[model samples]
Target: MTTFTFHGGAGEIGGNMLLIDSPGSRFFLDFGMSFKRHGEYFSEFLQPRTSNALGDFLNLDLIPDIEGLYRNDFLSHNKMKTSEEPAFDGILISHAHLDHLGYVNLLHEKAHVYASSVTKGIAEALDELGSGSKDDFVKTTKSFSYYENKKGEISRIRNCRDPEIKYSQREYPLTVDRGEFEVGSASVQIFPVDHSIIGASGFIAHAGGRSIGYTGDFRNHGSRPELTRAFVENMASSDLDILFIEGTNIDEEKGMSETDVGNEISRLITEAEGRHVFASFPVRDTFRLLSFYTAARNAGRKLAVNFRQAFLLDKLDSNKALERGKDIIPSHDEGLSVYIKKREYGLIGEDVEEEEKARDYDKKERPYVGIDNQICWKDVRDNPGEYVLFLDNYSVQELVDIQPVEGSIYIKSQCEPFDAEMELDWGRIENWLDRFGLQVKRAHASGHMSGGEIAEVIKTIEPKLVVPMHTQRPVLFSDLCDCEVLIPEKGKSYEF
Candidate 1:
């Protein structure tokens, strides 16, 4: 018997938690946060109290009220039941996107965590960088071999966890990607897929005379389109009983291919005169970063990245698999400069002496050494035409310092508004551009399969039952696909 339930991400775009049970053991495909769940009760200032861990989540229903799967320490701290027995086998992560893996922090330490080594590495790096306030959660561990650090060679990561822990091999299971693995009665195959973010994957689960395939989040128009095709071809022979897929962009406008997006941005940057080029895309989108780098290089300008991006590139290089594929990873000399925000010691608008600023800056080793590839707002302001700046929303204030001249270019190279909050933010972004007199040009691409493209993927898989997930418009898929469509409802269990 095989049963699966959707705790979240059914009829939504983000939070994805799926629990699967075979007769002998149980496993989870993802334990990501649900935006719908988070938005319902909390606003910016109003958040769950830190003192109540499981109490807030379980009572507020952010996390499912499951037994034994939560961390014993956290549950006990919250005065909730902390079962000694294990609830399920393990968790298999599809990608490093927070919507896909944000809730992993709340899991019991004993429950196995599985993902591609690159994903684990990136997750750890993000944790180290302290993004999204995940410092308290996100316990990701990986085994790497540093045969010799004397030469400063980055260690090679071996594998991604397959949701089982064998203490005999080491204290923890090797965090590596695997081809075939077993969890009780179910045997599965993990395969890589193309995505905007690095280390995205899909998996095939086989058990109880039924075969199912799960795609975490994938796109056929990424830099590695072949990988997506390979995933489909690899599973074609299985003749799947059911297929669970994501539809993040199903109800929205179809996106452009990465190459086309690159071309559009390149043309914009190349044609701009007497002004700087500024663009903002999701920082984790590895290919988008490379595209902007290439565009800057082709335009005879250097790409300036923020402190966080520089840190990410260095961490990525430490992983052998990802490092080898990089044509240009951010560094001081690789047409990349680390944008160091001018430090202010006193309250807002309170000016300090040049000596104070210089002395305080030289005293700190954090955010990379200032002497190496570090550019301040003044340097960029002076040399506007020589640099292309990668700006995230948080760093939007740097525009006041850069003081982009009239006719300067700003490309918003990400998808359009998906929600009210996003539309509000978009308006603020345009307002910032208007305030600075920067010319706005929008050139963006999505990181998911379109309705037409998804229809073709269904044609290839040929599953008997097709369940639409990670989408708001699952009904549209029925018209797009030829297979029997199943619209998953939240917390509903289904049998195959």
Candidate 2:
């Protein structure tokens, strides 16, 4: 018997947790957070209680409440049942996007992770560069443990104080080859697919004599459409029993290609003439970053990025998986430079004392602080036309220091605001743009397949059953797919 359960991403866009049970195997596809559900209860100031172990998350129904599937330390701390072994064989992460692999930290250590080498590198960078909580993909932090103090009193262990007791390094086996690998009784193969992120992939699993294919957020309009084309060709010949496809942009008719985006940005930069150009884009989307990079270089301007982006770029460049795909800007490129922000007490510049400026940066940021290609706000303010500044909402305050001139341009190379909170943030961004008298332009390419594109893929694959995951319009797929389209309910199991 073969079974499939939709733990998350049933009728939603993200939080893609799919449980697959076969003759002798049980595993999950992804374990991510639902942005829609999470936003309903928490905000920046209000968050899940770390001291409560997994109680706050399980009680609030944020994570699935399944026995023997989580870490022993958290379960024991909360007085819940602890299992010596993990219930599932392992988890196969398709990419490093938060919508796909955010909550992997809560799973048991034995449920090892399998992903491409580039995905692993990006996950490590996100954890190291982000806040200490919630982004621990490379290592799961040990929490809610207790120890005996010197005076013989029981005291809770602090991870910061005890360096050795802080984290448990999770096992990650790289999926580098095309051969089938075993996760308990199931045979699995992961193939690289083109998406917005660097190392996105899809899965093919054979369990209980059934062959299944899962498309984990793919696209055909990016810089490298050949990857997706090869994935479709592989599925066309697999004779798949079932196909789990993503329909994130199933409602949209079409989207621009990466070349189109680059062309538009090049035109914009050329017209910016003696004024500065500021662009906002997703930091991890290397294709989009390359578009901006190419545009700036063609227009005789240098591209400036924040320290965090520089760190992630370095990691991506070092990964060998990216070598065969779209090229990442070289670290030694003269057109690329790191933009330093004034932090802590806001002391910066060559005139400031070295000790005073050093206090502004954390230890991780010190390596790239005074490098050869580092640029400060004054450098950008003085030579407006010589640089294209990559600035996001969190760093918008730096605009006040740079004071961009009246005729400058601001290119938004990302998606539009989707929810109310993002809409509010866009309003604030407009206020800053208005104060500077800058013109705003929009140019971006989506990272998912459109409605017609997915329909073509369904027609090409010709699977017996097409189950929709990571989409809100599962019923819409019925009109597009010739095969049986199963609309799965959240937490319900279906057997074949």
Q: Largest lDDT belongs to which candidate?
A: 2
Q: What is the C-alpha lDDT of each candidate?
A: 0.76, 0.85
Task: Give RMSD (Å) of candidate 2 vs. truth.
Answer: 2.2
Predicted candidate 1 versus true structure: per-residue lDDT over 1-496, tens digit per residue: 7888998889999888998887876888888988767878876778776556557878888888888888665676667787875588778888888888888877775777667777776777666665222332344322222222335554432232231321111112434564877766788788888888888889998877789899989998888888899899877788999999998877655578889999998899999855888988888777888888888888988888877777777777666556543522745556788777755552212255544455444333254644467777887888888889988778888888778877898888887876787788889888888898878798877889888788888898899999889998889988987789989888889998
- 152-237 per-residue lDDT for model 2 (tens digits): 77777662545466666888875582456888799898888889987888988888899899999999899878989998988889
Model 2, residue 288: what's the lDDT?
88
Q: By TM-score, who's the top model here?
A: 2
Q: After superposition, how far is residue 51 of candidate 1 from its true place, in Å?
A: 0.9
- Model 1: lDDT to the true structure: 0.76
For each candidate in turn, the TM-score is: 0.88, 0.95
